[model samples]
Target: MASFGIIGSKGRMGQALASAVEEAGHTLAGGVDAGELPGPLALQADVLIDFSAPAALEANLKVARVAGVPILIGTTGLDDTNFAAIKDAAKAIPVLQTGNTSLGVTLLSALVKQAAERLGDDWDIEVLEMHHRHKVDAPSGTAKLLGEAAARGRGVYLEEKMESGRHGQTGARKSGDIGFATLRGGSVAGDHSVIFAGEQERLTLSHSAENRTIFARGAVRGAEWLIGKPQGRYTMEDVLDL
Candidate 1:
């Protein structure tokens, strides 16, 4: 059994991960809260699971690299700089990063990719997501994940084709660009949908998260799968072999 170290020990996801680790018959190496250092815990772990804030990602990767341990990052709201840091860290240690860790979401991404591939640019793509009121970021990571999948199918990058928060005299929606709409209210765990609009019809793929445990359980499963891997970046798709 792997010793899994949690980087956000006091949060809801952290608590759920602790329970998940035990349920999976794995050992908990230790954990760190927002202000605590994870270096010592990393040294003791076979793998590290991070659900902490985006700002702490670089430091967490450094400690994981120093300890020569693999890490699975489920933290969202990351910027380009954070991605650059992750890419660098992957050169030295195995790193698995994803917006949503739920296995169902992974499958949803694959389905979205396949649909986008089969339906061409003629069918416009749009993504919608809703989360708890406390979530600070617009367009939840899962929406981006699905958008990226769609973009990949269309042989493009999400960064270049993404459109969000359009207001005022936005004359017309671009032909092939992917758009996103975000909703915030109540205590929603998570909800995401991707719509493909054609001439007179629409096809939508969606996933709803009922609890944080789904993410935690999936993360623990992915973290266990990350053990003894070569230095490289990975995703939930790799862990699920989708």
Candidate 2:
């Protein structure tokens, strides 16, 4: 069994990851959070799974690099700096960063891409996502993941063609642009829908996360898959190929 170390041990996802490791018959090397350093845990683990805050990402990658172990990053709302660090660290050890870890979401992204490719741009694409009230980021990472998939299918970049958080005076929806709408409330795990609206018809691809276990389970499986890989970056898409 592989030894797994968690970087954000106090958070909900962290606790879930710990349980997932146990359920998957893997050893929990240990965990650290906030002020605690990840060095010791990194040393003990065969692989590291980071669900920590964006600010802690660099330090976590550092420890994993020094420990010579692969790392699976499940953190959300990362910035460009965090991504650059991940790229640099990945040169020394395997790294997997994903917006959403649920296998169903991953597959849904693929289907969205396929649908976007087959449909004409005359169909407006709008992404909708809802999460728990406590979630800090808007539009949710999974929404962006699905939007990016649509962008890829259309041979365009998400940031360039995306519009979100519409308020007053938004006028008309651009033809080639993808839109995003976010909702927050209650204890909903996650709900994501990608809509392709045409003149007379509409197609929607969606996924509902009933519980956090699905993500934790998929993350545990991803951590297992990252071990023994050559130094590089990976994603949930790679998990799909497996």
**C-alpha lDDT values of all predictions:** 0.94, 0.93
lDDT of 2 at 180: 98
What residue pairs clash in candidate 2, if any at all? none
Residue 241's C-alpha lDDT in candidate 2? 99
Best-fitting candidate, scored by lDDT? 1
TM-score of 2: 0.98
Off by over 4 Å in 1: none
lDDT of 2: 0.93
Q: Itemize residue pairs with steric clashes in candidate 1.
A: none
- lDDT of each residue in 1-242, candidate 2, tens digit only: 99999999888998999999999999999999899989989889999999889999999899889999999998999989999999999999999999999999999999999999999989999999999999999878899999999999999999999999699998988889999999999999999999999999999888999999899999999999999999999998997793
lDDT, candidate 1, 56-85, per-residue tens = 999999999999999999999999999999
Residue-pair clashes, model 2: 0
